[model samples]
Target: MLARVAAAARVRPPERTGALLSATLVLSVGKGAFLATVMVYLLQIVGLTPLLATAGLTLWGAASAAVAVPTGLLVDRGRGRAVGSVAAVCAALLVPLSARVHTPWALLLVLCVAGGFDSAGNVVRRAMLAGAGGDSVKALAWARTVTNIGFALGALCSVRLLASRSPSAYETAYLLIGGGYLVMAACFATTSLGAGRRGSPSVRAPGVVGARSLRTGGALAAATGILTVHTTLLSTVLPLWVTRHASVPVSVLGWLVMLNSLIAVGGQLAVSRRAATREGALRCFRNSAVWTAGCCLLLGLVRFAPTGWQVVLLVAATIALTGGELLEAAGEWGLSAVLAAADEHGFYQSACVLGETTQGAAGPLLVAGLVTAAPVAGWIVLVAVLGAGRYIAGFTTPPPHKAIAIDS
Candidate 1:
């Protein structure tokens, strides 16, 4: 039964292209934890103030937000190897420079370069997976699972490094993350997914429709809005809240994040079976909205956390919010991919990131501003957004029946 269940869990890959794909997830998500905890590290350990940390975050999010699409463009234009290698080297430098520099301007500069390069690399890797299209959805799910695994492991590792080391722990973490990213570049450059490395997505065409056929004007907007709020809370907002509220002793955070990643990985795999169906897509999105909203309200109630047990409960609630991320991301990608035109694969994938990054950029600033004033109120706003997302998800029609594949 265990073997049967395990067999059912993994779909056969189109190609046995192993480490290159795995390394992409490892590099991107491993560094991504810094999106949340690094703020705390910068402020508390590096001696930057709250406002400066916030400013640095805001700058990073703003500087080259559409990098995903351009990264996609680079691949489409056949510059994949060049962009991927350059971005990897940049990733190696982005955070380490932060440790030495305390000036807001210098940090923001490195942060911008880092953000664009990181964003570019994310698309390159996804394009790599998309290049494996006959295995498309399942492949992406595995990619998601691998990325989440990296997320869990990276968060845990960062915490351990911070705990045992002295004040230099933040520097150590950044350097290691940079090295991992540089290694990622090496893996990509040398492996089967390299630009020179050749294979095609079953056909060099989207099986559903061509890019021009995708419902652009209204459908994209509706879908984008629904997905934006879901990811903002999951990736940025909740992480920030935990860092601020439950984070005096940071050792426990890695496990909590790991647990969060584990739930997401499972959710991504479990839902993969029926998740692409139109009904299934709508169902998951709405469910995540309600789940996240309920979790948000729970965030406001932390004042009522009476003891250590309650603190644990609070952490659990936050984990639920993070779990919702898995549901939203899997479904969102499914919908976007199924409805996208053949030529639009690049845009189709970039749409999700662009949507999420737009919200993520705003989410932190919203969080920073609100928390800087009234932390609880900031949380209340997230609940409101979640509720609205759920409502939108429920009311929206499935994609049009014209040349699309909403799965079985």
Candidate 2:
């Protein structure tokens, strides 16, 4: 059954790949459902101040960041499936408890622990997806597409839930998220993943992967940093900038997010195929850099636009940013997958994820203070930062392994 599905989907290793995709879809829904309203839940149901809620979330992020490298190590040691399964179960059991926590410190501690497990689960899942087969890039692209669709649907649901503003609605969202994780765990449990599958190249590949890992990791990390600008802008920076500086209404933020997700869901697979080769990946990254820098500059000029024109400019900027993000995601997945040694993909990818982790941790702080204070100057600085990464990318070489070898 899965074989037929995989054949239709063009994913190899029919059964396992199908399972992974299904699991990814459900997992994404869960994540989107809860995250869309977590802040509201904390502020309204938990009765915490905005500062306290943000602080708790920040601490959770810190914990996730702290454990990422170690989790990668564990995944590489042939524990990817096990770790992900355990994480799913733990999340299922623990996530619902958030509703009962009243104080900030207690919420912080719960989230801190939950964050570590969540981070570990995510890294392991990515490692497993990368190891799916020769067309790991394609498989990941499919995963991303499904994730976006699921997230959009889930976010829509959360939006309706938010309208109610009832504690019961919030609890239901948490429980639904927990149930999603539980289902995802079962999916992982049934798959022949990690070191157990036949012809697992990672089992025969060299174990050390020392200096090679570092070189590849550093390059991918830079690429990740450049890509993160898209996320930081869409999620944190752009909304505030458009609302405060531009002539658009605050409601435009929701439309921008919806537009971004819609474009990704509709175009990710087609865009992903464009980065099938090393050169193609480089080109994608280059275009991403250019578009990102352009968007930043364009956004900087939004404030100077006529009242009616600001919305049009913001939409154009969003299109550029969205295109950059879509391309960057494809390029990142392709380059990182092809660059890492079969034996070292987990560790290498983890290092790459650190770029986003670091950016997520620091980007908000930078945007809140700088971008909020001076949107134009802040965006220009971002443009410079992304522009610098193009040179860094130039210095990066494809993995020493033949492209075919990496794919195999």
Best by lDDT: 2
**Model 1: per-residue lDDT, tens digit, 1-408?**
899788765755447456765675667555765654677766776667888777777666665455866665556545676778788888788767777677767876778778888777766666666555564555677777777677666666666655643557667667777887888788767766532132324244322333333344134435455555645554555566566665335555556655666677667766654556656766766676766766667766654565475467667676777656766766665655554434444555665666666666776556556754787777677667667666655433444573335332
All candidates: TM-score: 0.75, 0.89
Kindly report which residue stretches of model 1 are placed more than 4 angstroms away from their true locations once superposed.
1-14, 28-37, 44-46, 164-173, 190-259, 277-279, 297-323, 367-384, 387-408
lDDT of 2 by residue, 87-188 (tens): 889988768877667677888788778777777777777777877667777877887888888888788778788898888777777887888788878876
Each model's RMSD to truth, in Å?
A: 5.3, 4.5
Worst 10 residues of 2 by lDDT: 195-204
Over 4 Å off, model 2: 1-15, 195-207, 398-408
lDDT of each: 0.62, 0.75
> Per-residue lDDT for 54 in model 2?
83
TM-score, predicted candidate 2 vs. hidden true structure: 0.89
